[model samples]
Target: MSRIGKQPVALPDGVTASVSGQTIEVKGPKATKSFTATDDVTLEVQDGVVVVTPRGKSKRARQQWGMTRTIVANLVHGAKDVFKKELEIRGVGYRAQMQGNTLKLNLGYSHDVDFDVPEGVTVTAPKPTELVVEGTDKQLVGQVAANIRDWRRPEPYKGKGIRYKGEYIFQKEGKKK
Candidate 1:
């Protein structure tokens, strides 16, 4: 039994949802997002709530039951509000800034790194060492933050690199004589 799949997703005020075949579309003030569920699960909207149920008792159907529900819920949330991810540069010379539509990064490299901002997502650097990635889609926002962090992941010794805000790095002891 999938407990999570049984719970219905409620549509908040100013948010609306529609069902067309296997696809569900959620419309809100900020944006509209749609999701197409696999045949293993059934999607329906009833009395302003979205429901998901597995078509059969097979393993694959059960595996998709909960996942389908979560995806539908994410679409509802994404349409209503923006997902944000914050990144902090820990290195001494590492920093980032927005130049028009591009994000200029200085991660102690010989040449500066530039990242192009994608549509529906906004990358802003209020401070040189701080970055905020905002977008309607949670997946895109997280992916952008991960790509930025991948440039220079924090090391254990000095903890020098880019990392998510409030994330802790396990420091290792330096070489001893």
Candidate 2:
């Protein structure tokens, strides 16, 4: 049996969940999100709780059940509360700013890279070198943060560029004479 898959997902007040076909719809006070189950997984809602089960006694089905359940749980939680990702810009001349709904980054590039913030997601720069990404959807929030980080990933030599707050970068030594 799958430990995570067998766990019951509790529904918070003002949140509603329903299973139709292979789709699980969760509606909260703030927003609503739907997730589709894979071929080897099944989703069911009972008495205000959601359950995930494998379709058959196969290795693939077993593997998917737990993962599907976790995704569904995240969706439910996201509908109620926002998820956030924080990044810091290190090195001279590295900075970020918010222009309306777009994030403007200066990462040593000749031209600034402008990233558009999608609906339901907000990007804010508390300080020129600190950025915060907030949204209800976990996946979307994380993906956007990753995209920004990819624009100018931190280098080992100088530990410069964008990186998650408190993330450790292994510094490389200079070449031997």
Candidate 3:
């Protein structure tokens, strides 16, 4: 049995969930999100809660049980509130600023990197070195932050580059005799 699947996801006040076949849709004040579970798992909304159960005793079914439950929980949470990811830019002259819907990054490159902000997600630069990504969809918010960080991943030698807030980059010794 899956411990996580055993626990139903509660629907908070102002949040509602509905199930149709294998798909579950959650609606809240912030947003409405829907997810379709695989055939190995079943989705149901009952008594102000969402429940997920496996259709069979197979290993795949067992695996999908927990995964499906978590997905449903994420949908509910995302519908009710926004998800956020923060990034930090380290190194001299490296900075970021928002230009309309685009994020302009200066990561020590000869030319500035222009990142087009996709719909449904908002990228804000509170400071030159700080960036905050927010969206109703958790995956999209995290992916946008990762893409921004990929332009200048921290190097072990100088530990200078774009990185997630609180992320530690393991440093290596410099050239020695």
lDDT of each residue in 1-177, candidate 3, tens digit only: 999999999999999998888888899999999998999998888899888989989999999999999888888899889999999999999999999999999988789999999999999999999999999998899899999989999999999999999999999999999
Q: lDDT of candidate 2 vs native? A: 0.91
Q: Per-residue alpha-carbon lDDT of model 1 for 1-177, expressed as tens digits?
A: 898898999899999999999988899999999888999999988998999999999999998999999888888888888899999998887889999999999999999999998898999999999999999998889998999899899999999999999999999999999
By TM-score, who's the top model here?
Answer: 1
- Collision count of model 3: 0
lDDT of all predictions = 0.92, 0.91, 0.92
TM-score of each: 0.98, 0.93, 0.97
Candidate 2 residue-wise lDDT, 1-177, digit = tens:
899988988898889998889998999977899988889987888898888889999999999999998998898899898899999999899999999988999999899999998887899999999999999999999999999999999999999999999899999998999
Note the residue pairs that clash in candidate 1. none
For TM-score, candidate 2 versus 3, the one ahead is 3
Better of 1 and 3 by TM-score: 1
Q: List the candidate numbers ranked by TM-score, top first.
A: 1, 3, 2
